[model samples]
Each structure stands twice: as C-alpha cells, then as structure tokens.
Target: MSDIDPGQARPPRRVRVDLPGRAYDILIGAGLVDAAGSILAERLPDARLAIVTDETVAALHLDRLTASLDAAGIAHAVVTVPPGETSKSFRQLEHVVDAILAGRFERGDAVLAFGGGVVGDLAGFAAAIVRRGMRFVQMPTTLLAQVDSSVGGKTGINSPRGKNLVGAFHQPDLVLADTSVLDTLVPREFAAGYAEVVKYGLIDRPEFFDWLEWKRAPIFAGGPERAEAIAASCEAKAAVVIADEREAGERALLNLGHTFGHAIEAAVAFDPARLVHGEAVSIGMAQAHRFSARLGLCPGQDATRVEAHLKAAGLPTRLSEVPGAAIAREVLMAGIAQDKKVKRGRLTFILTRGIGRSFIAADVDAAQIDEFLAEELAG
Candidate 1:
C-alpha cells in the first residue's frame, strides 16, 4: 500500500474496477447518496434505472435515492422487496425478473441494487437472467456488502442445498457506497459488516490491519474519515476484483472466511430467523484461524489475537455456543467439497502464515481438518 499525503485526505477519490466492457468506479464517502444522480449521469447516461431495495432500506433511504434520481432526471422505478435473507431465493429472483419485464427494462437498463448483500445478490442474479442480461449498479448499504459481496460480481441465490450455490459473475456498472448508510445499521449488524472490512487487512495487508487494530473506535464513529477508511477497504477489494472478476483463482482468496461461514449459515437453516451472515463469518474466521494454526500454516498466537479482537468487537468466535457443532462441521465440509476452489477432489484452504500472509493449502488432510474443528467445537 502506498501512502497519500495528509494534504490529500479531503480530496475526492475514486477506485476503478477493470473488466473490459463491464469496468466501473467505486465512489466511497458521505453524501454520496445525494450525488447518485450526478455519478450515474456521468457513467450511465441515457439509461432507464430500476432501484431495487428492501423494505427496511426503502423506509430509511428510498426518499433520498428517489430524490437523487429526480435530480439526475434519470427515468427510474423503485421496486421494494421484503427485508432479510429469504429475499435471496428463486422465488424472489423470479418476482424481480417479472417486475423488470413488466417495467420494460431493456438490455441496457440499469438495475441499482440498493441494500445489503442479499439485495445485491438477488437483484444481480435477476439482472443476469432477465432478458438475457441487463446492466446494474451496486449501491451497498451495509458494511459487509460494501467490503466483500457487492464488488466481486459473484451474484447468486441460496438453494436448499447451500448458500450462493446458484448465481453468475454479473459485475456492476458502478458501485456507490455512501458511508452515511452505516448510520442506520444496528450496532451488532455494524460490527458484523466490520468483520469483512478487517478481513482485507488479515488476508494481505498487515499495515492496514495494524491501523484497524489501533483505530477501531474512530472507524466506527461514522465520521468523514471513517468513510475514507471504508472507501480504502473497497479500493483494496476492487483491485483484487479487477484482476479476477469471476473468482477463477486469485479471486477465491476473498472467500477466506466464507467457506466456513456459508456452511454455518446452511447449518442454521439460512435463518435470518436467527443467524446473520457477518456473525457466521466472524465465527468462521476464528475457526479458520484455529484450523490454520493446527495445520502449522499460522502461529497459534495469531489465532489468539484474532480471537481477542473479534470477541472485543462482540463477534462470536466459536461453534460450541451455536448448538449442533458436529452437524455444522459436517455441513461445512460438505460445502467445502463443493466450493468452487476444489480441484481434482482436493480442497484448497486459504490458510494464513500469520496476520498479513496467506497461501493456498491444497493437501490439508480431512482428518486434520476434523480434529481442528472438533477442538474448536469443544473450546
């Protein structure tokens, strides 16, 4: 990571995602929602837009989003879905597709996904299939969506078998992240999204991780600088996404905690009835750290530190408390076997060498994995 002078802190900044015809810019800051029209005006001129959001976000931010569209004079319609993970399903995707068709959405009409990962995934999946593919923009409202799911173009729906088991690589035309949206998230949800933000540092940027460890308080303060930090995290993610838009190889690195996380979600029955994606990812990251240490890929001390930070942030770090630990492990292994990363019947686990270093582990035996998970369950 390079350093920008403090003098440039307040300057408007942009990170570009390169993907041939699908390339886009991610704009991160406060008041970005107000600038949505202008941003779209520049990038998506002459496009009819459909704003897809959930009931919760529609209440909190719809007026402003509509106002922005009004300001930009972008002809658009607002489609609201019921809030929660259930919205990411074939039923919901079909409903959105029908709505888009009814709205006469053309191939170039932009679908603006304006909520968390669920909304983005569901709407993006619909965009992928609707009329054979329409353009879309990502307006991630939650921290988790902003840092991880929304940028990579890996859009999909969860099936009874697993999470994100059905989807496509439909990248957004642009990503608009207004950090002000973080204000509407409850504390726990906010903490959950922050977990993914910390992940960027854990996966490859030790210096950024150090900054997070030190500035955790200010980052959560919802200030302009916090918006900058969020933007920086998106910048890191956008760079990785530009290189691998389809999770072919290096892009799978983004799944650092998700392999275990998705399994936990599946085990819990994809319950917005109880478990949240970020919560599951927190516990999964801890489990990954423990498993990595057990495999000697990372020092035990690193796992201990990760545990401390997660716990301090109110993220659950173990499986024992969640009931059915063995079932969770079994289901998680099943998901890993089906993970897009598997090759020739072998799984590729992205284990850490320490806080800032990670590598592919293609030969970690199942027995060792089971033992490590068993210990996590017991601990």
Candidate 2:
C-alpha cells in the first residue's frame, strides 16, 4: 500500500517479487527508459542484450533507450514487430526467436521487452525458449503492462483456441516501469489500462478501491496519483506472484475478470478496435459481479458499485457496449471452455462475495453460465 502525498514530489518506488531462487525487483518511476543503459550496465554487467519491441513503441521511445544503452557501452541488438494483439501469434514468436538466434545471444544474455503487453509476452516467451532460457527484462511502456502483465511472469501468445493459451511462466530478471512513457498513450489506451488498475481494488483491496474512487481524476491527470496507482498495482501483483508464482493457488484470484474477458476477446478473434484486453476485462468483471449477485453469492449493490466506478473511469462495462457483430453465445462459451483454468473437464472461476472478497470457485456449473450469458446477451 502506498501513502504518497498528492502535494509532494514522489520518489521512485521498488516492489520486490521474492521467489526462493528467482527474486526480482520492479522499479517504478519517470524517465527510467532514459536511465536504462546505466541500470542494465550495473545489474547485468557482462550480458549482451536483445531489445524486442513493437513498431509503434519503437517509433515513440526506442531511440532514447538505445542511446541510453550506447552511453553505458552495453552491447545490444533490436528486433521490431508490428503493434497490436495480432502480433502475439506463433508466426511472430517464430520470427522473434529467429531474430534473437541471429543475434547469437547466449543463455546468460538478456532480452528486454520494450513495449506494451503484446511485446512483453512475445519477447519473454522468446527468452524462455531461446538457448533453453535467457535472462529476461520487462521495460513496460503502457499502463496495462506496467501494472499487471509485466510483473506477473505470465508470458504467452494467444492461441486460435484462446487468449494466452500458448505461453510460459518465465519471470523477468527486472521490470522497469517508466510512468513517463504513459504520456504517449492515447486516451482510450490509458483508459483500458486503468481497468487493470481498478482490478487490484476489486480483487481484495476495498480500501484501495475507495481511494481510487476519490482520486480517479487526479490519476487520469497524471498527478502524483498516477505513480502511486502504478506503484500500488505493482506491489499488489508482486505479492500474489510471490505467494503463487505458478498460479497453482491464490494466484488465480488475479484473474478476477479474465475468464470471461478472454472469451470475449476470442469471440472477436482478438481485434483491438473491436475490443482490447482491458475493455473486455471491464465487461467481464462487471459480468462476474452480476453473475455472482444472481447466484446469491454477493450483494447486487456491490456489483452495481463496481460497474458504476468502471464506467465513470471511461471503460465499457457491458456486452452490448462491445462493437461489431453480436458475439454469439456459442463463441463466448467455447472460449470459456478453452480457458486455462479448466481442469479435468471442470470449470473454475474467481467469484466474489463482495468488494475485496474474491474466491476461486472450482467445478462451476456450465449450464448456469450458459443461462446467465443468455440473459446478458439479451439485455
């Protein structure tokens, strides 16, 4: 929990993910990209680097990062991919792995993920398999990556079967979250990321959720609240990763909205313009709460409060809000069936008793879900 004062200048924050033999630090601050050369030079003195980024981010921030590396005399090579969810495919993964091999980077060297979630997942997965396992670093540039994906070690590309089905649990050696870079994001992108920020609160931090409600405007305005939000999110995610790095237990709680969200994403074939990850999550979370209430597992008002807050933050919170053709019930249900959380042909979902009271419900009834989604679609 961060106690940053709104009126004071905030210092950089560090959240450590302390695994038994694989501990790493998440450094959150402004201008970290400009300082990356010295940072890498000090920590990984002898390791050459492979910088993997997307074109959009390459255009926006790659030169500054390269210059920083050059100044520190750290040897490096760059690999660029197209920007967007489509890049997280087997084809692109092969392309990146080949590029890394072309650089002749060794197992002891590092691969730096230099964009949003797509680049981080693609690059980290490449690092996991390259030379049997290279060191990985996350330099997340988007609000979503900075707060969630970059910290958790859940790296993977989407399968045609599902989102994030083909990947690995390769944690990064370090995560450099440059809040300054978020200034380059479009408003819609920022709002999408904010959905993940709102997630930490809904997943067991009612006090934090309360704080977000009070400070939403300041956070959106890029005040001290923004850094505090990022810091708090990293801290929240780090705590979960430390407890269950492989997502074998409590870690599943972090996917509070992902089961339904991934389904919606798969339904659209992961089109960003139709629906991005965070927006799908916003809708999924709202649906999760509404379903919880319908099942008498949570108070209806709690679900209402969650939806209202997310809507106020400029996020879409309903299936109807999703653009394009109506996502058929069968498509969404099939996506849910393919979710990684399913085990032994049984379903598992993170349901809530109220705000900050999420619990994993294994063996959830599929028929009930079908009925609930039907009502959701009709409304």
Candidate 3:
C-alpha cells in the first residue's frame, strides 16, 4: 500500500537547470497537471500553447490538462500521435510540425510535450524546427521522462540507421513532472523508469544507490521515498546539464548505461513490449560494470551488486532477459557504431570504475565491444 494518499497535495520540489541564457525549472509533485494551466498562465501569460502528446497519455491525461487550461482561460491546441517508441520517427515529427504550422503557432508560442520521453523528444524536435524554434515546456507523464528526458534539452527522432540519430539541443522553458501520474503506469512501465533512477546512483552517488536498495519497496509503493528519489534524480541531472548542456563534455556521464542500452534497444527495434528504454538501460548499466570489471577497471563485486539491485527492482539486467527472438551480435554492434557519442568512427562509452565513478571513455576499441557483444549474445 502507498504511504502517501492519492488525493493529498504535496508542495512541488524544484530542480533548476541553469543554462547560459535558457535556464528552466523542473517542478515535481502531485497535482502538477491539475495546476499546469495557472502555472502556464502566470509564466507565459500571452503565449498560446500547442500541447503535443501521444494517444496513451492523451487518453489518460488530456482532459485534466485541458480542463486546467480552460479554467485559467489559456488558449491552446492539441496534437496527439500514437503511443510507444515507434512514434519517435520522422513521420511523426512531420505530422507534429505540420500541425503546429497549420495552427499558426508563432515563435512566441510554446510547444508543450505532455507525454513520456518519446513524446518529449518528438514534440521537442517539432518545437525546435517549427517556426524557427518555439518556446518548449515539458509536462512529462512517465517516470522515465520525469526523472531523465524531461530535464535535458535533448530532443530528436530515431533514424533507420540508429536510435536518436536525428535531433537537436532545444531546451525546455519549463518542466512539470507530476509524480501522481506514475500511479497510472503498469508495473513494468514503472520498473523500467526506475532503471533510470538507479542510473544516477550508478553514475556518481553510491550513497543514493545504497538508499535505493533500502527504499525500493516504498518507492514502488508510492511513498515519500518515491518523490524523494525523483527529486534527487532531477538534481543530479540538472547539475550535469548545467555544466555541459550540449553533452560536449561532462554531460555524457549521464549516459552511463545508455551506449549498450541504446544498442539493445536498436537491436530489438525499439519495441516497448520487448524492452523499454529503462530496461535496456538496466541491462546496459549491468553490462558496463561487468565489462569494466572484465577489463580490470572496476571491482567484479560492484558489477554483481548493480545487477542484484536492478533485479530486485524488477528491472532486466541482462540482454538475454529481453523477450522475443535472440538479438544478433552484428545488429547490436551496428547500433553501437551509430551512437551519438561515437566520434569519427571511434566508439565513446560511459564506463565506470565502480559505483558512483562513471566517466567518459572516448576512442574505445571497437573490437573489444564486438567481442563483448558476442559473449553477451551467446549467453
């Protein structure tokens, strides 16, 4: 049972991502969706909003948001796409851009991404390119989006060549992460998002990792720990984004498990049923630790501990755990090669020395990754 009451209103926690001239705040709490209209009305008083969401989120949350907007007398339009990873494509991007243009949204107007990472990415990209980049706001409805994607300015659509191959660094004007919305997620979806929460600890907060292990149940049960975890994760990400908004340097640390994870996602064709982003990241983080240990860079026990914690959280920590047909080593490697971190054919990965010690490893040998993939696939 949840320790927090569903109808209770908690004051929102704020994490600020302070970029040079485009700083934004991520407000996390219950009832944010219901309060969004007044919030937006206060911040962008004259600006009309184009709410871009997906079918799933729209069905579950559109009314609440629209009702709030209506209450505040804020003018808005909605553009909804099909749900899931498949919607983060060029076709959907075109559709969203066309809709915004058709609605005659001006540069001063805002594009509100009211879904998970896919919607945030797709809608943000549309906001970036349409009308030469309209103001963007993130109203992320999923755990994954709330803790990770919603804070960063990274926006894009997946290309046939690889995941997130086409995108832009368009910062959001504001981010509202309503923790209450997480209750509507299926267990698997919530677990997948929890994988990302674990990532912050893995990247550089060993104490946070230890805390997660102790508080896992409460988090899953929607206790105060759940909100605490989200706020901590956001703070971690905001620090990184503040230091390296463009991912030119330290921001890459945030992708600690993403290289291998993205490869697995690409191999599985980004199918949520097979493996969602957070689940792939769980596997990738485990693999990264294991690989680091294999290369004598990290302690083997740390890798085991990571896998153990992820498993306890109901996250898949191995590629073999991904459902459906076996993922080919070649396909996995192809996906890695197209990773955004790759530079001039040299593979760049976020590897760790141990818990809370992740770092960027540029110019990693491709052969080593191939060998690792072969071993993982064989298992």
Q: Top lDDT: which candidate number?
A: 2
lDDT (10s digit) by residue, model 1, range 144-215: 888876567889998886667899988888888877778889988999888888788878888888788787
Q: Which ranking of candidates, highest TM-score first?
A: 2, 3, 1
Candidate 3's displacement at residue 199, Å, is: 0.9
lDDT (Cα, 0-100) at 137 in candidate 2: 94
The TM-score between candidate 2 and the true structure equals: 0.93
Q: After superposition, which runs of candidate 1 have C-alpha atoms over 4 Å from their true positions?
A: 1-12, 321-340
Residue-wise lDDT of candidate 2 within 98-214, one digit each (tens)?
Answer: 999999999999999999999999999999999889999999999999998877788889887556779888989998988878889998999999999999999989999999999
Better of 1 and 3 by TM-score: 3
- C-alpha lDDT values of all predictions: 0.79, 0.90, 0.89
Cα lDDT of model 3 by residue, 170-269, tens digit: 9999998888889999999999999989999999999999999999998998877888999999998888888877667998898888989988888887
Instruction: Indicate the residue-level lDDT of 30 in model 1.
Output: 69
lDDT of 2 at 345: 81
- What are the runs in model 3 whose C-alpha is more than 4 Å off? 1-7, 374-379
TM-score of each: 0.90, 0.93, 0.93
